[model samples]
Target: MELGVGWTLKPVGFEDEEDGQDAKKIVDNQFEKMDYHGTIMELGMFYRVLGRACQVNTYDLNGDFYFNKNEKVTGADSINPMTITDASLRKVMADRTGTEPYVQRVTGSVGNPGTVELEQDRVIYITNNPFAKYSTYGNSDLNNSVTDLRTLARFPHYRDALARLYSQMHRIVTIDSENSYNIIW
Candidate 1:
C-alpha cells in the first residue's frame, strides 16, 4: 500500500489569496518532481524497521516552471541511519529539543574515515522511541521481539515445520459449573 501526503495553503486575507494559490502550485510542483510519495513510502519502512530515516533537501529555482519539469526532480537524497554519527540539537523547551543546525555523518572505515557535517536546514532527521523527548536517537520497533526472532531463526527446517503445524491446532475443554471438579475435553 502507498501513503499520500496533502496540504492546503490558506490565504491570510483576501488581498493575499492569489499569492496563496501560487505558493500552493509551486509546492505541489516541487513535490511531484521529487517523487515525494515514493520517497515517503521508503522512509516510512526504514523508520519502522530501523528506528530512524532521513532525507536531504535540494532545490533548483532556476529551472523552468512547468515544461520539462519531470527531469527536475531526482527526489531528495536519503542518508543511511547507520552512517549518522551525531547531531547538534538546540533545546526548545525543558523536555523538548529540535535539530536546526546539522548532523555528523561518517564515511569510510574506522582506520581511514571521513566525516561530512550536514546542516539541519538541508537534512531531515527522523527518530522514534527515544529515551527522552529530548533524546536524539531512536530505538528500533523490533527491539522487544529480538529474542523471539532469534529463536525462530535458529530453528531447523523440521522443527520450524512442526511448530507451524502445531500452531494451527486448537484444543477445547468444558467444565460443569455446579460440580466444578468434573470436566470434559
Candidate 2:
C-alpha cells in the first residue's frame, strides 16, 4: 500500500548582519495547509471545504491569486511568474517584491472605479470558479463546478463568487424557488 500527498509551499526570506558578517535566508516555500487535510469525516466534504478555503482566500486577498508558472519564481527578482498555478492554484506567488507597478501602488483617488483601495493586490487571476451556482444540499455547487473548474475559472466573473457568498452565505436555498441569484452587492 502507498499514500501520497502534496503540501502548500509558502515563501520565506530574511537578511542578517552579525559577527561582522552579512547573511541572508531564502526559503522558497513551506506548507501552511497540512492541518486542513487531516481527520476527514467524508472525502466529499473535505474536498468541498478545501476548495472553498482556496476560493475564499483568493477573493479576500483582493483577488491576488495565481498558480505557479516557471520552475522557479522568487520575490528577490525584478520579475515574477504570477500565473494561476496552471489553474490549480495549488502553488502561488503574491509578488510582494514591488516589481509590479499596478500591484505596488495603493491608489484611492477621487475618480477611481472602486472606492476602496485594494486590500492586498490584484492579478490577472485564473480559477475554476469551484463555487459556481448549483443546488445546495448534497448537490453542492462543487458538483457541476468541479467538472470543469479550471475552465470556468480561466476568465471568471470574479464578482460572481463574491456576490454568491454575500447573498447566499448561510441562507439555505430552495433551488428553483429562489430569486436570490439575481442579487449582487
Candidate 3:
C-alpha cells in the first residue's frame, strides 16, 4: 500500500541585511534556513498521519517531545539524521511468498541498457510481487479521493506558510531563486 505524507512550514524571522559581512555568517544563516524549513515539512507529514490515527491536533501530535523549544521549528527533529546518512532514496518492499519484508533496492546503470541487457553493472530487484491491480470503480474512487484531498489542501495555505517561515531566506535570493522556492508537498 502507498503511504500518504503531508508537510508544512513555520514562520522564520531573520536578522536584517545591515548586520552582514562574513561569508561564514551568510552560509550559517542559509544552513539554518534549510534546517528549519526541512524540519517543518517533515514534522507536518508526521503530524498529518498521527493526527488522523489519534484524532488530535497536528501541533500536539509529537509524542517524543522532539519539538520542544530550542529544537529547530522545522520537522527535522522528528527523524533521526542517521536514517538519511546517504543521499540515496529509501523505501520499503514487501515479500510476496514469505512473511519477511525487506528494504527496497537502490541501483543505477552507467549507460542505457536496452530491453535485453544482461551484463549490467548494478541489477537489483527487491521484490517479486506483481503490481496491484485496480478495478474501474477503484480507479474512479481513487481519483475522486485525490481530487477531494487536493481541494481541501489549498495551495495558498502552503505558499503562505512557507512565505512566512522563510521570509528572510527568500529575501537573500534573486527572483529566479524565489521561483525555485515554490514546493509542492
Candidate 4:
C-alpha cells in the first residue's frame, strides 16, 4: 500500500456501507463511522437535516408524467426477481434518461455500492417483490399503464427518497470537513 513514498498508509477499518438499514442503525453507524465528537442533539439535528434533504431533493429532477412510472426495480432483496419474460423491461429501463446513464456511468466504477436491477424493457407492474417493491415491472404496456398519473409519479425520483438519501450520504462521506458537516442543512 505504498503511496509514491510520501503519505502514510491509509487508515484501516473503513466502514462498509450497507443499504436498506433501519433509521436508528443508519444514524448511529453514520455518526460512529464519521468519528464525530458531537452531542446527540447535533446527531439528531444531522439526521433531521439529512431526512429533510432526502424528502425535498428526492423529486428535484423528476421530469414527467407518464403512463408507467415507479417502475419496479428488481433484484434488490431477492435472488432472481426478474423472470426471463421481463427481459424487455430491463432494456426499457436502460433507455430511460433517469436510469440509463446511472447504469452506464456506474457500471464499472470501483467501490460503487449502488445497484440497478434491470438491464433492459418497458413495462410496469404493481406487484412488488421484497427487492423491487418500489419498482414497476411487467411485459405489457397495458399492464404497466394506468389512468392516475400521480400513482405513477416516480419519474426520476424512483417514487421515493432512498436514491436521494444515498446520494446525500455520498456527499457527507466524501467532504466531511468542519464546514462541510452542515452542508446538508
- Local accuracy of candidate 3 as per-residue lDDT tens digits, 1-185: 01133222223443644444454466456446546444445444443432211011113354421233464333223342222212121211222333332222223375643222211112112111134321111122133245535654776456565546545443432223434554432
Q: What is the TM-score of each candidate against the true structure?
A: 0.52, 0.16, 0.19, 0.14
Candidate 4 ranges with C-alpha deviation above 4 Å: 1-76, 79-87, 99-185
Extract clashing residue pairs from model 3: 11-165, 12-165, 39-74, 39-75, 39-76, 40-74, 40-75
Candidate 4 C-alpha lDDT tens digits along 1-185: 11111111223354542332344465455434432223223323322332210001011135421221244211111112223224433544345454532122122347765444432222222332335533434232233234323454656455455445545545432334334444443
lDDT of 3: 0.32
- Compose the digit string of candidate 2's lDDT tens values, residues 89-151: 222233445343222222245654332222223332222243543211123345645534565
lDDT of 4: 0.31
Local accuracy of candidate 1 as per-residue lDDT tens digits, 1-185 = 22223234454554577887887788777767666666677677677778877776665576432323355435475556667655343321222334444545564555666766665556676777546654456777777667656666786555666567646654555544446555444
Residue 135 of model 1 has an lDDT of 48
Cα RMSD to the true fold for all candidates: 12.8, 19.6, 19.1, 21.1
lDDT of 4 at 55: 7
lDDT of 4 at 146: 44
Per-residue error at 110 for model 2, in Å? Answer: 62
Two-way lDDT contest, 1 vs 2, winner: 1
